[model samples]
Target: DTAVSQTPKYLVTQMGNDKSIKCEQNLGHDTMYWYKQDSKKFLKIMFSYNNKELIINETVPNRFSPKSPDKAHLNLHINSLELGDSAVYFCASSQVGLNTEAFFGQGTRLTVV
Candidate 1:
């Protein structure tokens, strides 16, 4: 079974459109995160949740929202998508402790025209 999974491996949309990406992890991890990899391949954490509680939230735009229905699922919703939003979005999960490894999904590539 896949440890982590995301829907719509590829997404193509126009500017000002709204879209959402769904993610789920079966590893039973206590912590989950949302990351963004830009064109330059710089990976940055956008949001983090521990046991369904918001923990870390980076300096992301208000258009980006992350929702965790439970410990195993975290979803991202983007409103009024912009060209800058085009990047690889990654969903990851970890046990939240020292030396704990994080498992990541294949990523959802979002492209805005």
Candidate 2:
């Protein structure tokens, strides 16, 4: 089974629309995160949740929201999407406390026009 999985691997939408991407992990981890990869392939963490509580949040715009329903699930929602939001989104999970290797799901590429 995949350690992490995301739905709608590719998304194409018009500007000003709203969209959501779902993610799940089966690795029994306590921390889940949402990351965005820009065209230059720079990965930046947008939000992180540990044990269903927000632990880390970068300076992402209010348009981006991350929700974690459980320890193994994290979802991202974007409102009034802009062309600048076009990028690849990845979901990752890792155990909390000690340093552990993170597992990433196949990224979801979003294109806004």
Candidate 3:
């Protein structure tokens, strides 16, 4: 079974369009996160949730929103997508305090035209 899984491994959309990526973790982790890897391969955390509670939220644009309905699930929604928004989005999960080691999904590559 996959530890963390994300849907639509590849997404191609035009600017100003809105899209969403779904993620789920079956590792029974308490914390889940959303990360973005830019063209330069710089990985940054966009959002983090622990047990369905918002924990860490980076300085991302308001257009990017993360929702965690439960500890095992976290979804990302992007509004009015821009060309600069093109990147690889990764979904990760961890036990937090016990083990900060995170398991990441294959990632969803979002391309904005």
Best by TM-score: 1
TM-score of each candidate?
A: 0.98, 0.97, 0.97
Better by lDDT, candidate 3 or 2: 3
Go through the candidates in order and give each one's C-alpha lDDT.
0.96, 0.93, 0.95
Cα lDDT tens digits, model 2, 18-70, are 99999999999988999999999999999989999998889999999898877
Give the worst 10-residue stretch by lDDT in candidate 2.
93-102
Question: Which regions in candidate 3 have their CA more than 4 angstroms from the true location?
Answer: none
- Candidate 2: what lDDT? 0.93
Predictions: Cα RMSD each: 0.5, 0.8, 0.9
Candidate 1 residue spans exceeding 4 A from truth: none
